[model samples]
Target: MWLLLLLPCVRADSRCKSDLISSINITAKLQSDILLPCNFELTLFKSDMTADIASVWRESPCKSELVLSLNVTTALQSDVLLPCNFSPGLIGLNTTADIAAVWSHRNMTVNNLVEITLQGQTMYWKNYNRQIKTFSSVSASGNFSILLRNVTQSDEGLYQCDLFNGTGCRIAYQEMHLRFDDSPADGFLTWLVTAGALGGGVVLLVFLITIYICAKRSTNSSNESVSRELYPPEVPHDAVEYTLENPIYDAAVQSETHSSFRAEKGNSAETAVYTAVKKVKRKERKPEEVQ
Candidate 1:
């Protein structure tokens, strides 16, 4: 008789234990963070209580065996998005349902990163100093995804997402594996490009300077050649010597003429004349032909 009364609770527990399984693998670059998608649809039913004792009874229209696995890779100091969403239609449009989501990491010292609670149109969040965040209107859309800001090596681990109904019974479960890349090659490549640009600039400057110097030397040499052509030097001439053998008058003739003129003109006026003379030596001829 007692077993018959507990049958309903056992069946309800078994139904809640059934889950849907999924798997995903992602390869992300070191430049940006990665998004892990976890989306599913569920039907939530109203809880029932037994008359004799207070027993929570819940139901779900899910498969017997369901599993979801995600592999994500990202860089250090990058933000990550762990997506988790469910269909809100099954919660009923005119009815109010209490739904809660909890995000935790197994390897992290602070396991509970975020906790969200939704009561119909109202939503509440509990996180660690805003390090983890979720949508403000999570109740309307049934999106329980969390954002991890500035992920580091400590954030690389297995993350679990659990969903509970008003009765505090877990209805859904999800798992995600976070990982980091071995090396960050993007930063190194950027550095290399910058260095190459600087080197090219230096080489270009040197080439320009060399061309300027060569042009200056050529211009100077051309100016000197033009000056030599425009102005020439004067040449020196040799001097010549001259000899005068004849004069204007003889000295004895001039004296005799002067005396006759003085005697003839004893009672008249006398005239005087001036002359310049140069003497030369004469060579004698041989006189032995008569002997």
Candidate 2:
């Protein structure tokens, strides 16, 4: 009898275990429709889950606190979506709550843009109206994301989303920036400075190359001129060392001519050539022999 009772209790315990999720995994895009996967749920994800999700899980006196995750960037006059979704155990179980997304310019507290609310309404604080809307079925899907249509320069500031439930209230803050393009002159000035720097570099390089070539050519010409000056002009090598050797043949010829002239009779009346014999000093070829 006790065994039969324990079997029923075990079956009931197994059913309850199957209903509760063991682990949840999800992946999503920013500022877009959040997908609820029936296959997997999203549980407390952070490693220190107790610190962040204690408010979502604790009983009766529960509290909610939000963290600002991402900053949004957009251009003026464009329709863009800002992302703000809070995940808690209550949003998944109840499928609704007092969820609100408010956009506020810094220093303008009274003029808040209560653009999107989970109660399926859009309201403004300063009596201003624009096409700002949030998804109606987002609560059912546990997403409280909003969309702003035709944004303006004045729309640039901080945005907040406050969540309220039986737990407590949590506030999330995100910054929105309106981007502007640089002025025409600013762009032109940057281009002008860059072009001038590049052009100056090119000109300086060309000038340096020209100077190098000219200097090399000048050095070569100077070397050639120096060589020319070293070897002086117009003095012949043969003229510097040549000697006049008379060979004494002229004296021998005059002596022989006088002998012949003496043989002739009428040569006495003309310039007479006399055969006078004298010893000629014979110099040795390399002069020291004679010395």
For every model in order, what is the number of clashing pairs?
8, 1
Candidate 1: clashing pairs of residues: 20-66, 20-67, 21-66, 21-67, 21-68, 22-67, 22-68, 22-69
Off by over 4 Å in 1: 1-67, 89-95, 108-110, 119-127, 182-291
Number of the predicted model whose TM-score against the real structure is largest:
1
Summing lDDT over every window of 10 consecutive residues in candidate 2, give the lowest-scoring window: 272-281
Q: Cα miss at 138, model 2 (Å)?
A: 2.1
TM-score, predicted candidate 1 vs. hidden true structure: 0.39
Candidate 2 clashing pairs? 62-167
For model 1, residues 1-291, the per-residue Cα lDDT tens digits are: 999989988987975764766788899999898899977544433344232223322345232222356887888788888877656643345325566667778873647766676642323345464567677476556677778889888789998877666655666767889998755586788788999999999999999999999999999999999987774432211221112433233334444534544445452221322222322211112234434
Candidate 1 lDDT score at position 207: 100
Task: Give each model a TM-score.
Answer: 0.39, 0.36
Candidate models: Cα lDDT each: 0.62, 0.56
